[model samples]
Target: MSKPPLIFAVVVVIIAVLATQRYMQKRRQDAVNDASPVRTLQAEVSAKREFPAPNRRSRQREVIAAEEMRYEVYFRPLSGGAEMMFALPEKTYHDMDKGMRGELSVQGTRFVDFRPDAAK
Candidate 1:
């Protein structure tokens, strides 16, 4: 190949390598950023006794009766005026009824984006 052409080819290869390196570096930085813990708000319901966990999954419509009973709930904010009840998955009604306070931390999506039953 001609001298100028060879030089141009070498320059193109160097540019491509630098670009790839930069892209990889940015990807690593992004992963680190994503792994960092996100901030969230907390609140408590003092009036109630314990938060109820429905027998059925939230996807299925199940009516929770107010007259039956109610419980104090500590929750993070959810969409609209609603909030999610934070509790143990394996807990029973009596366990939930024990009247106590709790704490929670949420991340990723906005508090407003959370659903009424979005606890895990």
Candidate 2:
């Protein structure tokens, strides 16, 4: 092949690679955006995961992790509609269980509060 044709082919390959990367990234973002609500009362603590300590060195000079044992709460999807599981905290995870079923609050994928069934 001629030098000009070879150079053009290389450029085309580079463009194709870049386009593919962009498309994949968009697809990943869409997956997150499509998720409406990842939490429901019926959701149970499917699993517990350990997380590293939070960065307390902030401008506020405050702390988030009070205990050495940090955990992430994983909620089982309800009716498989959401298809997205979320994590919060150890306290939140323990608050919700199979026996309890009620309102569960989540703030930015973190468990805020869990209201158990009053009837139960």
Candidate 3:
């Protein structure tokens, strides 16, 4: 009924809608990836990144909670192509490094596997 509450409600609804849309879009992408043929190509690990989970803060700004870390690996096709980044499990992410050349298996935008070249 009040302006503050009304504004809060609108903001919450907007956030919910955006979150739902993102979830649905991700589901659609997963389905598309599932239908795509897995392709293994020569590529190199061009970069790697890790995002540490943010700590939740209370009204007093004290840390309240923390989340799991997220990791992504970037690849560039050896033959030349646009680079792609994919989220990877922690262990696998840790095992990879920049400039490692090898086979990269992918389906659609999903990362399947990366096997570094034995010589490298």
- For residues 10-107, what per-residue lDDT tens digits would candidate 3 score against the true structure? 99999999999999999999999999999999999999988764546423433334546779889999899999989899999999988999999999
Clash counts for all predictions:
5, 0, 0
Model 1 stretches astray by more than 4 angstroms: 1-4, 39-120
Off by over 4 Å in 3: 1-8, 55-67
1-120 per-residue lDDT for model 1 (tens digits): 646778899999999999999999888876765676765443433322444444443544444564223433445333234555533333332343222333334443212211222345
Task: Return the number of clashes found in candidate 2.
Answer: 0
Q: State which candidate has the highest lDDT.
A: 3
Model 2 misplaced regions, further than 4 Å: 1-41, 50-67, 82-90, 98-100
Q: In candidate 1, where is summed lDDT lowest over 10 consecutive residues?
A: 108-117
Scanning candidate 2 in windows of ten residues, the lowest lDDT window is 58-67
Better of 1 and 2 by TM-score: 2
Global lDDT of each model?
0.46, 0.58, 0.87
Please give the lDDT score for candidate 2. 0.58
User: Which lDDT value does model 2 have at 24?
Assistant: 99
Better of 2 and 3 by lDDT: 3
Better of 1 and 3 by TM-score: 3
Instruction: Name the lDDT of candidate 3.
Output: 0.87
lDDT-sorted candidate list, best first? 3, 2, 1
